[model samples]
Target: MSQKDSNILDLLKGNLVKGDKDFELTDEECIGFYFSAMWCPPCRGFTPKLVSFYNKVKCQGEKFEIIFMSGDFDEETFHEYYAEMPWAALKFDLSSIKDTISEKFNIIGIPNLVIVDKAGNLITTNGRGAVLKQFGETVSLTWT
Candidate 1:
């Protein structure tokens, strides 16, 4: 693995979650950092679409995962919003980690989807667009 990729995985330590269980990032072909908040209407609207894409990928046995970086006001709100997602999330207490990620990706807005390949090279910061265009086609062409 590249240094960048290794660093990202290290940075995410102790902050990942899947369902009610803690999970680790391992062997994903690609990763998506979804920056969003429950209070944001646009974020709420886009989340389900992302979820649909997530489900489709899972059903097809794609090696991908999305990690939510919550911008919610509190941990309770973050947990409530996270419960609705089918993907993993960064814990709310890890605000510094979230902020670092956001700044690293130049995320200035909610609902921004930044995707990285297995090697941790950024595939696209406009994952929302990729998700909208050609669904399965996008996965094969752009993500892997």
Candidate 2:
């Protein structure tokens, strides 16, 4: 496997998760990340919309979920402020690989969405559209 592929092998293998540190993606659970912050206006603007979408999917019994990565803040504030989020979020404590995500994904600003499947493969290059499309698709499939 290439270096990148090898690095992501675990995420691909369903190792990354929320709530339960031991819980993995199990052929279900659509994992996504909102690369934003509580400080940025656009990030704030998009948050509620994202939350609404999440609530809808959750209500419909979809197996997908999202997380928040505070691209530019400490973990304490991240958790304290966004405690009401419908989805799981990365712990605010770890900041080591923060840039790794930005560099690899080329995230330039706030409100960027990064989504990976159960196997850690990205769903689309277009983050915004992929988030909407995938979450919507999951909801639709689950409800009907």
Candidate 3:
């Protein structure tokens, strides 16, 4: 997939961190914005499930990536929460960008997962549901 989505790229580029290294988006077919927080019990419950699904799809060689967007109250909390994720996350300092993404996606609650195609166009807002129900057995194919 080509990095044709400039807006989306701008929103995410240079702001992703995975473990101790800087992360970059690859030529993936799509990207998933996982809006969640450490304080939300529901988010805590769903995050691991999503991470498992993410890892499973990755192991299957799926060309997709998930970027965690924290809803935490502070950077420390965001960092602490993000550390458990296997995928990359938005920068803790770029809180406005996170809010922009959340508003753009019309996210009214935590544990919202939105998928966007390579062109930066939204593919689905019910990503959590899709991963859990629609494509539980073949989660990777859900993006394709």
Candidate 4:
């Protein structure tokens, strides 16, 4: 495998939670790394919007997936926040991995969505903007 694929595998090695079940990454054309927290008011507001967007694209059978990277202070908060999301999340116990990902992406704030291609190449760091400004099909076209 390439270095980028190796890095992605290391980062996403652990269990990913989606609702009550564990989720595995597959042949998604795009992956979104979503950084946010329950304590952040902006995150609280944006989460619902993102959920809607996710559902819309998913219903359309788009090969897209989002992996939440919680910034919550506790596991309980992380669970609470994650319950409202429809996508998978890095386990709360994997804070070190999350930190590494945050640093790699230069994440400076909550509610940030960084999009990457299947090979782990960056598609856009301004994914939140793309979601907000474009429809699901438009966003997919831009990313892919």
Best by lDDT: 1
Model 3, range 1-144, lDDT digits (tens) per residue?
Answer: 322323765778788988768998978888999999999999999988898898988898888889998889898898889889999898888888887788777999989999998777899999988877743475664642
* Clash count of each predicted structure: 0, 2, 0, 0
Model 1 bad stretches (over 4 Å): 1-6, 135-144
Give stretches of model 3 more than 4 Å off: 1-6, 134-138
Global lDDT for candidate 1? 0.84
Q: In candidate 3, what residue range of length 10 has the lowest lDDT sum?
A: 1-10
Clashing pairs in 3: none
Write down the TM-score of every candidate: 0.89, 0.70, 0.89, 0.89
Clashing pairs in 4: none
Off by over 4 Å in 4: 1-6, 135-144
Give one digit per residue, the lDDT tens place, for model 2 in 41-101: 8777677767777777678777776766676566666765566566665555544444555
lDDT of each: 0.84, 0.59, 0.83, 0.83
Clashing pairs in 2: 12-119, 75-92
**Cα error of candidate 2 at position 128, Å:** 2.9
Off by over 4 Å in 2: 1-29, 129-144
The global Cα lDDT (0 to 1) of model 3 is 0.83
TM-score computed on alpha carbons, candidate 3: 0.89
- Select the stronger candidate by TM-score from 2 and 4: 4
- lDDT by residue for model 1 (2-99), tens: 43344565778778989888988888998999999999999998898888888888888888999999999999999899988999998779888787
- As a TM-score, model 4 comes out at 0.89
